[model samples]
Target: MSQMVRRLNDEIESTANMCVRNGKVELLKKVAREFRVEQKSFLEHLEELEDHIYLCFLTINRSRRLVVRLGHTRSPKHQFTLQELNMFYPTSKRIEDPGGT
Candidate 1:
């Protein structure tokens, strides 16, 4: 299991590296379309990913790779504070409700 997860993480990091070479917003669009992930969903991952790569990590889903961030960002909402990505962004489970998972 650990081996599989490590491989999945590797794929994600590589994909993210390619995206970064492009622009964050542009890459966000590309990843969403290619991966079938929502735009906001991808953005939340970026929000979690720090400008630096220190926090980038990978996880495997089924046989696919997913890169996640270790850092947290402030919510540009009506206020600013440390926020979780899943909290502000919509996930596969709850589309767009911060309150839901």
Candidate 2:
């Protein structure tokens, strides 16, 4: 697993974001070639490794970046009635088909 992680660190273009660590198909093939494994197997391993690494960073960053609820807020209480939604339709066409049927 350390070897795979090392290989990934070497292969990745950037260290700033996990999006870069998620395997591109071409990149995965290249890693597979290096490991002499079938691309499908290598890709599965890559995904698992990336998930583990990403989760580690997420855990580390969570406390520093955590958002706190600052104030009391309530969900919107207003509900739109059917008539309110009918403003877009022409009032002259009252047959209820709206589709002009």
Candidate 3:
């Protein structure tokens, strides 16, 4: 079970790498369309991680990789803060309420 979960994690990481190389938003949408089940499973695995240090390490590493792949962007509009994200972006579960409360 651990092995299978690791493999699935690797697959999701690969997809994420590709997403960073391409347009992250577009590639993520494509993945959601094509690999919805795997995407959900990967998220579930992340949620299951019990160790804060390990989870933070993994999250930071993945975020760094994505940032590096993004290269240096000249446009400031592409960048968003956590506050803006929290204020504006809606989760998949509540996408219907995109207007944000």
Candidate 1 wrong stretches, greater than 4 Å: 29-101
Give one digit per residue, the lDDT tens place, for model 3 in 3-90.
7679978998898888888868776877778777686886676667746657678777876765665545425557754443343334
lDDT of all predictions: 0.51, 0.56, 0.64
Candidate 2 on 1-101: residue-level lDDT in tens? 67967786675635323443674556655654776767578779779888998988876565334321111232356554445335433577423535554
Give the clash total for candidate 3: 0
lDDT: which is higher, 1 or 2?
Answer: 2
Question: Where does candidate 1 clash, by residue pair?
Answer: none
Point out the higher-scoring one by TM-score: 1 or 2: 2
Instruction: Indicate the residue-level lDDT of 8 in model 2.
Output: 67
Model 2 scores a C-alpha lDDT of: 0.56
lDDT of 1 by residue, 16-100 (tens): 8777887676876676578675657755775555433342332223113211233323333434222333444335543454565
